[model samples]
Target: MTSAASKTFVRRLGVLLGAAGLAAPLTVAMGATAQAATSACTAGTGPYQAKAERFLGRTVDGKQSAADCRAIRDFQLDHGISPAIGYAGPVTWAVMDLVSQQRAAGDNPNAAGRCPVNKGRIACVDLTRQLTWIQDGKRLKSGPVPIRSGRDGYETRTGLKKIYWRSIDHWSTLYEVRMPYSQFFDGGQAFHSIDGSVWSAPGSHGCVNMRRADARSYWSLLKNGDDVYVYGRKPGT
Candidate 1:
């Protein structure tokens, strides 16, 4: 026989877990409800979403399902993605691509290395991956975003650099173009969203080009004096 106070404490813990969606209560239709939650994507959806559905272990028909989002979020957590919103956003997609690339190449999918010592909010770039990740030293805050660095001629300088400047809407006088959410690390190289094909090509002259949304996110995350470490050679380099 348990004490009343002990029983109340357990019940309160259950409520907190339930509120956080950590544990669902014992519902009437646990079996049937499970099926409904794991919905398949319907037709007319983008191939990318279908890929995400499959990656999430959900039916890849073409549909939106909370179950899929939860799976995606869980995957993100395992991969060191932050917030774990469950939405297959730009950051998620970028990570997915990186994983796919690694799998295809028979390489390790967990592609993180030792971060810079004492570098708070470090921005890490894997040239081999063509990916960027922002983290507070050991903890990832955002990214694994697809990025484009200098092409054949003008290779983006590698090695560790510190962010020294930031601009919300900066126009590059050297390139004569607009660089949104620009965080400058190397002398003339910065991480900024550009109008180019970052998904398929390393199209930048030398600066890092990110997707518009990712640039916005980077702007919100990084600040001056943050360490930026660019490592590994870009694929096919």
Candidate 2:
């Protein structure tokens, strides 16, 4: 073979080797991710293992299993729980418990009559259940949706209040955060949308933190002077 042709062949071989080297790591990374997703399930039993098992309709054994981990992890991921490794920790159980409460509410969240039916076109917030809904007399207008209310020390004030102000693009000066679809009902407290998951531990500062869709719907359904009845104590507060 000619010297020039030999040199060209060597250059092509070098390029092929380099490309294979790069492809090898990429293939390994993809495989690792897939393996981690399936194999990262915790083997040790979580504190709420039995409760989680019961909730998920798995065998009532408190011990953790690969199956249990997969089931719990799926639930955690579905609820936006972070580090969703399938551990039945307090946070996971708390969310599951909340789901149970919401299911019990069914079609009539106001069946208990805790929220006064006399008020027309009012928004009712049940802090205990971490749920909120809008009602026009006896008619359910929207949600028994999950909410993240004031955490511990910053408990949301309970009482009958009215939305006195609204800012679609509100930027909080005190907290230095964006509070989208803000509807202020009491003091600095308001119904607002947060970027994070509502089920996140502890809770919000003092406002009713809702998902983006829920906040938008609330903004459209409610207006200034709309009655907002905030009652019941939030679990931790």
Candidate 3:
């Protein structure tokens, strides 16, 4: 072949090879996406299938379906469960159970009279239900909101305490983490905001981990010397 013709052929071949390379990655990416979607929404029945179905308001047939998988997966993702693949496993069911109890509290979280009512402007932490609220002589000032207390070994201390310190932007030297809107009621444990999901599990290191918005609200509503009553028992602990 002539030099000019050979050069033109080489250019065309290069273009074709580049296009093929691009298509290869595209195809692999598509396959990976499909696999992920499939894994994230399995059809196999989990141990707590029936309870999960009932909690999710789905038909309690005690079986896993495509629809059930999707619904359960969504709930898992919302609550920050790992491998949120729509599995009705114990973790998912446990979270659902906690949610049910929280909802049952409704507007009157203190209806059971667990947290003292007469304390003027007091913060109540119900460790059993993983809930917290602020009340003033029976009037709900704020919350009944979700909270992630300390883990099994590092259970948040129970009993009446006071907010001894307040730091809007506190950094934990021990854990090397940022504790935003920290209000310390105990030695090292405090009410603070974490960047991660408050419902992620295993809980914190004796601190009451709150969502960002909830922590900010707590910062605004609480101050030094405010009463804090922590009661009940955290489930795993």
Clashes of each: 5, 0, 0
Q: Which is the winner by TM-score between candidate 1 and candidate 2?
A: 2
For model 1, residues 1-237, the per-residue Cα lDDT tens digits are 346765566568658756865423322223564356334222222336667887666898666565666677667666656434465655567667766764553322223454564677788877776777787756667866778787778778889899999998999888788999889999889999976557444357778888899999988888888889888776545
Tell me the tens digit of each residue's lDDT in model 3 across 85-199.
6778888898999999998988899998988887799999999999999999899999889999999999999999999999999999999999999999999999999988878
Quantify all predictions' global Cα lDDT against the true fold: 0.69, 0.86, 0.87
Residues 1-237, candidate 2, lDDT per residue (tens digit)? 566875576567647756754211111123554465355564468899999999999999899988998898889878888657677888899889988997788769999898988989999999989999999999999998889999999999999999999999999999999999999999999999998888777888889999999999999999999999999998767
Query: Model 2 misses residue 148 by how many Å?
Result: 0.4
TM-scores for all candidates: the values are 0.54, 0.81, 0.84
Give the per-residue Cα lDDT of candidate 1 at 36: 61
Arrange candidates by TM-score, descending. 3, 2, 1
- Preferred candidate (TM-score higher): 1 or 3: 3
Once superposed on the true structure, which residue ranges of model 3 sit more than 4 Å away at CA? 1-40
Model 1 TM-score on a 0 to 1 scale: 0.54
Q: Rank the candidates by lDDT, best first.
A: 3, 2, 1
In angstroms, the error of model 1 at 137 is 2.2
Q: Measured by TM-score, how close is model 3 to the native structure?
A: 0.84
- Candidate topping lDDT: 3
